[model samples]
Target chain A: MSTPDPRLSINQGTLKYADLATALRATAEAGVQAIGLWREPVQEVGLATAARMLTDSGLRFSTHCRSGFFTMPEGPARRASIEDNRVAIEEAATLAAAGAAGSTAVLVIVAGGLPQGSRDLIGARERVRDAIGELAPDAAAAGVTLSIEPLHPMYASDRCVVSTLGQALDIAADFDPAVVGVTVDTFHIWWDPDVLASIERAGREGRIATYQVCDWKTPLPADVLLGRHYPGDGVIDFGPMTRAVMASGYDRDIEVELFNEDIWATAPLEAVRRTAAGFEVAVSPYLTE
Target chain B: MSTPDPRLSINQGTLKYADLATALRATAEAGVQAIGLWREPVQEVGLATAARMLTDSGLRFSTHCRSGFFTMPEGPARRASIEDNRVAIEEAATLAAAGAAGSTAVLVIVAGGLPQGSRDLIGARERVRDAIGELAPDAAAAGVTLSIEPLHPMYASDRCVVSTLGQALDIAADFDPAVVGVTVDTFHIWWDPDVLASIERAGREGRIATYQVCDWKTPLPADVLLGRHYPGDGVIDFGPMTRAVMASGYDRDIEVELFNEDIWATAPLEAVRRTAAGFEVAVSPYLTE
Candidate 1:
């Protein structure tokens, strides 16, 4: 097989079934230089041990997979979510420090869906802004950048209220870009008519914390969440988006975060290799040489 | 049941299996005041017979439901789609003339998806603008308003490229408002952060040809196309959207164009009644008194 792209980072969720040691081993064994970790596996081994294992793997940590479903109103649920996010902030900082020198202390945040049985979308959105406000200081204190991710609109009512990069940036605006920014994932925003402009704005505003690549296709699977494909495997034309992100002065490892069932069913090492291959073809062409 | 909202129009798609005669009869029997029709059922009876039936039903015609899937490059298919749209425009005019006073000759347009195997969304969208340019004169001559309907972004790949009201209005900007307008549908755009602004803009530009309502719920059915629900059955708060459209000075009949499997399985008249009931609770309160 050809050499993997140096800038390709394997997002852990792509290896959905892999445990921490296997995930790290497979990604590193595949000759991939970086991996983004999810909370479950990190907590499975505990933070310090997970960080030490990550260091032994000799790979960079691109980001902490996620932890920001705090779109609930003030109450027990909201308090629990807030406390969890604080822990996530610390996790991100610890992992970033334990990984290779270039690791970034960024925690991707998915603003939760509408509270159960509530049709108050406007209210739900306001709460996301408020939740971020509550979490910003904690993130800053932990030395972690909380990256708000704008999920696909299909997930608006059930998974996330933040459904656009511009919206994410708007919430991120009140905080330091170093503490709170946005996650630009092609799978979620590729269909946006104003995506290129939004990317430029995110850059101008210095709010792009991470740039993740994936592909989107229709006749989406039974579970829409698992419909994301390897970068070159679907209809997404990565050229313009990749070029736009690069032109916006974003210089960082691009994570391939496929959530497809087929990919997860494959061996983690194979998945990483395939992800690297797809990224090289679909996204690498637009990067600055 | 309570008297149907006078402004509520049962979009024929809500009765997916109903022939033109049955759809007209069911809607009129439901005490609904108007309807928007699909070309298939209209053409099934032939336009003249359909127009006569509509006149007999005594319901206002809200929009022609719909015909504008010409997002391909120069080819025979594109030519056929354009010719078909011209026919659709003529039908909209004839039906509008035949319906009771206050009927609108608005032909709803759904810009087709990406050409098979092509990822040129920008190009596909441009072709929609170009196709509108080509069809504008025919529409104007026929006294028909071609209303561009931006389908939800989920349909961007295999259904419609126009995914936001703002984008639709931008395309309509080049033509006279009377000839080129937009269809504002709640189910398609309720999640948009800029939906309220787009609705206001559509009104400011005199481009809102039709206002359609339906609800969006989670765990979208296998065929995402059929996941639409009766307005109040899902989490979409139609209040703001309905209010914005009304405040935009849209005085036309409001169409409830649901595309759901279970609803379609119900009796057509019952489905219309349910739709009316849903709209009364979800949207009617937001209408100008």
Candidate 2:
């Protein structure tokens, strides 16, 4: 097999079936220099033990998988979500500090969908902004950056109300760039008319927390969430986007975060190897030139 | 039974199985004042006969159910598509004149998906603009307003390259507003953050050709294309969107176009009744309020 790309960080979502130990081991053994962690696996092992495992594995952590579903009205559920997010901020900071030197203390946020029995999308989006505002101080205190992720518009009703990078940046503008930023994921925003311009703005604003790469193909699976593809496996031309991100002065590890069921069923190490190979073929070239 | 909203037009797609006669009879029997015609059924009866039947039914014609799949590169296929669009424009003018007073000669344009085996979304989009430019004169001569529609981004790759109202308006900017306008469909654009502002801009620019309404619910069907719902059944708060369109001085008949398999399976007249009822509850109040 060809050597893995050094800048490739296998986001744990790609190896969905893998637990904490398996994910880190698979990523490192596949010759990938970095790995992004999910909260479930880390919580399963408990944060302290997860941190120890990361230190021993010697792989860098690119970002914490995610933690931001605060689209609820102001109630106990909302309060609980806010408190849980505070704990997540601490977790992201601890994990980053425990990982290798290049690890980044960034947390991806999938802003929640509209509240149940509600057609108030505008209200839900406002709650996302309020949730971020409530969390920004905590993020700054914990030295973690909350990266708002705009999922594809198909998920706007039930998964995320924040469905555009420009919207994400607009929300991020209220907070300090270091404490709040946006996640640039290709699978979600590749179809956007304003995508390149948004990337340039993100870079100019100094708020691209992490850059994730994946492909989007149609005849999307029954579970739309699992329709993501390995890089170059679908129709997305990564050239302009990758170059735009590069042009934005984002010199961080690039992540491959697949959500396909077939990929999840493959062996973790094999999946990591395949991810790195796809990244090398589809995205790495744009990184350099 | 609740009196049907006078402005409610049942788009033929909602009664997918209905032939032209059946659709018109069902819609008219249900007391709906207007209807939108699809190309297939109209072609089945031949446009002239369909026009006579529409005149006989005494229902106003709201729009021509779409003909614009010109996202391919310059070739025989592109030429064929442009010619077909010209024919469609003539059909729209003929049908509009044949229908009752207040009928509109609007041909809805669903700009086609990326050409097969092509990842060039930008190129495909430009081709759509170019095709529109080629067909605008034919539309103008026929007294047909080509209404450019922005499909939901989920269909961005395989169905329509035009995926935003702003993008549609941008493309229409080059042509006279009377010749090229936009279809404001709630299902496709309700999730958009800039939707209200875009609608206002469309009105201000004199480009609001048609306003179609449908609801979006999640766990989209295996065929995502058929995931739409009647306006009141899903999570969309139509108040703001409906109010925005009303504020734009859009006095044209509003259409309820749906593509759900279940809705299609219903008898034509019942489906029309349900659409009007849904509109009555979910959208009509906002119109006059």
Candidate 3:
């Protein structure tokens, strides 16, 4: 794989609730090298129309935004989760046909705090694995790879319970390599003691399905449901992490994914522009020549 | 060692600006069984007066509040940290003489954040070990155990670098058992994946010097410096954690330590009473008959 171009890739969710065509046109004009299309946008425009627009614009397709919230242990919820991921795989496939440059890898997985009254972390993990396992064959058949994104441990309760890269890799290991992988978002795993090692391992295993960048702000409030910092503002040491990804021989587009209140409050184009600049400066020192 | 009664405790620095005599009088009347004193409080009333009050009131000293910001790596600054810890050890000895029950230990250390321009976590960890090694002998001689409190990783940048119970135990293992041990604070370490294992290990190794409790709230603002949640109001899975501590053969008082704007706004007695009530209710499910 070639070293990921550091230009810019807009995660569609950043402009959530905005008109898809307008957002796409603005993102492309802002000099973004690629765009991470989401399900809602594709659904709204009709997959065919969305695919044709991407083809006409000639923008590189980075990985799809997501597909996985496999936390419910059993019954209707687990079946519903599998069906949703299958739809996400189809969305990725549709985007791929529309002229996305990369493979149709649907980012799979969501995790959060355990169900109330549940104290069994290992058991909850098993539930995640089982849910993903059930969806793997379908994803592979649809020509899509499931990219499990491990959220920050703080979100282990209500969001994505998969809190570490290692844990994600463990779940991936249970499936055929072609069917499962991971999305490395800096915001989630930046504080991990084993982040560098895990990044390298992800590269070595060829499981680095995505590389997302963001910063970690200190004095983060006890309630962090939507309070992330922009890339340059927080204290996460991203230098070694970038180097580890590079050394692992995984060269891919670095996606700037910020979930900050300040950015969300601004115009979508403004957030995109600021994010692109932050990514360049923050990762400049560690970028491979 | 006998389990110290949890009732006889005085919150150090409760009267941050008040004279030590006044604080001690309030502590005595509150019917607190012991006092968790701070160095500055003693200085304000003069060691002679503060010592007399504790002796007069028959208050036992549970433990001193602190002594470690061991993250400054090198030269005079690092040496100063060691000397300051020594002073704290001396002060702990004085409190012990003033009717403090059992041996008095300085809350050994707080880990400092990433040094300027360096993201070398391994190197920072080494500095912590060195600081502890330098302070151990003086603390042991003063009859003060250096209780290494593993702070929350949120404080991993500017405050405490030792962010997990396991990390504290590892640092303690490098020293004489008599001089070093681990203090487990829920506020600081409740989020750790390895907390239960570490606590069990601490108990097996007889290295549990303290156990404190607090809650973690959500919708946390980006600035964590001002974000602390009162006990029973946040996402910490304390019930399971408390049960794990008890299972580890730790039969000790679970100190209720909270630092939050809401609590600080209330009268200290009210804060104490509410905290006690929260503790009883939250941990009741996990208590062994």
Q: What's the true lDDT of residue B99 in model 2? A: 88
List model 2 lDDT by residue over B32-150, tens digit each. 99999999999998988999999999999999988999998888998888889988999999999998999999999999998889999999999988888899888888899999999
Q: DockQ of candidate 2?
A: 0.88
lDDT of model 1, residue B116: 95
Ranking by DockQ: 2, 1, 3
Mind giving the per-residue lDDT tens digits that candidate 1 earns over A23-123?
Answer: 99999898999999999999999999999999999999999978988878899999999999899999999999999978999999999999999999889
* Docking quality class, candidate 2: high
Which residue pairs does candidate 1 place in steric collision? none
Q: Give candidate 2 regions above 4 Å deviation.
A: none
Put down candidate 1 lDDT per residue, B1-289, tens digits, no spaces.
Answer: 9999899999999999999989999999989999999999998989999999999999999999889999999999999999999999999999999999999999999998999999999999999999999999999899999999999889999999999999999999999999999999998999999999999999999999999889999899988999999989999888888888988888999999888889999999899999989989888888855
Local error of candidate 1 at residue B97 (angstroms): 0.8
Predicted model 1 interface RMSD:
0.7
Name the docking class for model 1.
high
Per-candidate DockQ values are: 0.82, 0.88, 0.31
Error of 2 at A6 (Å): 0.9
Tens-digit lDDT track of model 3 for A1-289: 1223354577776766557786677677777767787777778878789888887777767777766776777778778877877888887877766754643455645654566656556667778888787888888898777888888766665666687798789889887766788988887876666777888888888888777777776556445655566677777677888888777776566677656666777888777777777776777567765
